[model samples]
Target: MRRGENLRSEDYMLIDPFINGVAEFHDRHRDMRLDVDNMSYEELLALEERMGNVSTGLSEETIMKSMQQRKYFSIAEESPSSLEPCCICREEYVTGDDIGTLDCGHDFHTNCIKQWLTQKNLCPICKMTGLGT
Candidate 1:
């Protein structure tokens, strides 16, 4: 998925309610895996109801604030010798690339870090809460 892209409703429907992993839902009547796209509107509604509410964690506003507070620095702004590649995307930082410094002192591409923060509030490297609770 690209940075800042919202997951589709179908993606949410496939998420496992008990675990974060995705699970193939079986169509008991048909004795086969549930095909979300092929299901009728009523069937979709019933499946959604069964899944119940799913939480993606931190609110948009909170994530935005956390993102805003992140220290942004480009390779041009800092010495290239001090720059490091973003671990999440496994891409090297370019001269003009903007990087966000997390509270844990780990740095990543701003977009990469923002994407990660949406699902988790912790710094990926240290697993420290970056949202300040």
Candidate 2:
């Protein structure tokens, strides 16, 4: 949560979707053996268009802004009957643990959900868009 703080392996694991997506994209294009250095202007434009169609291009700044907009709370601040473990880590939320409540109404650890949104702008549970298009 602070500058220069070390993140756990779980944090990296949360971003596996994006990493795997890129790998899969490369795998799909392996046979083409496209050479970027030799691409013409038109070919570059066409490639950019195709990539735009494939991904939303969500960036780190966009993800941080979205995360900041969400409401943060502790488990003790909510009713006991409504308490639930974070779906990302499958861990119970302690009273003092920081939680983020997304617009979709799902709650998760602030760090856990932030990492997820950075890779994909969808709620981990419902696949609903969590950030503005």
Candidate 3:
């Protein structure tokens, strides 16, 4: 069957409620993930993948150890200067301003940045990976 063209009434009746429940559950527990101190390395990684959030409860020691084990690592840019202002807007940085940094080392004002990412997965500056910024 073609994608999304085989749904039956019963499917909606069953799936909609489950989807709503899961959404509600996520909204309620969104900030309540298990702390890194309480989580094994495996558990922490699994939670990270499941929620796609940066865990804050981990200690620097544990974080270093986990990295030594190849458990987790950051893709954050080396420094803010490693990147340039967004190409989409062709603007320069202003002091004490709001900005968003992407995984690819690009920065932009949050409002303009999101619209660009929504349209494509490329850096507004270099058109590299478009996961964030």
Candidate that scores best on TM-score: 1
Which 10-residue window in model 3 sums to the lowest lDDT? Answer: 65-74
**Ten contiguous residues minimizing lDDT sum, candidate 1:** 67-76
- Tens digits of per-residue lDDT, candidate 1, 1-133, equal 5668897867656553435555656667895568998999999999999989776556657766765444444644576667566889988776567677677778788888878887878888888886664
lDDT values of the candidates? 0.72, 0.71, 0.54
Q: Regarding lDDT, does 2 or 3 come out ahead?
A: 2
Tens-digit lDDT track for model 2 on 40-78? 999999999887855543676766666544444454557
lDDT of 2: 0.71
Work out candidate 2's RMSD over C-alphas. Answer: 23.4
- Alpha-carbon RMSD to native, per candidate: 20.4, 23.4, 18.8
For model 3, what is the C-alpha lDDT against the true structure?
0.54
Clashing pairs in 2: none
What TM-score against the true fold does each predicted structure earn? 0.47, 0.46, 0.32
Put the candidates in TM-score order, highest first: 1, 2, 3
For residues 1-133, could you state the per-residue lDDT of candidate 3 as single tens digits? 3576988866665667665454334466768755689778888788778878553233333322322111122235545565556466766555555566566655566546556655555665776764521
Q: Tell me how far the alpha carbon of residue 95 in candidate 1 is from the true structure, in angstroms, after superposition.
A: 1.7
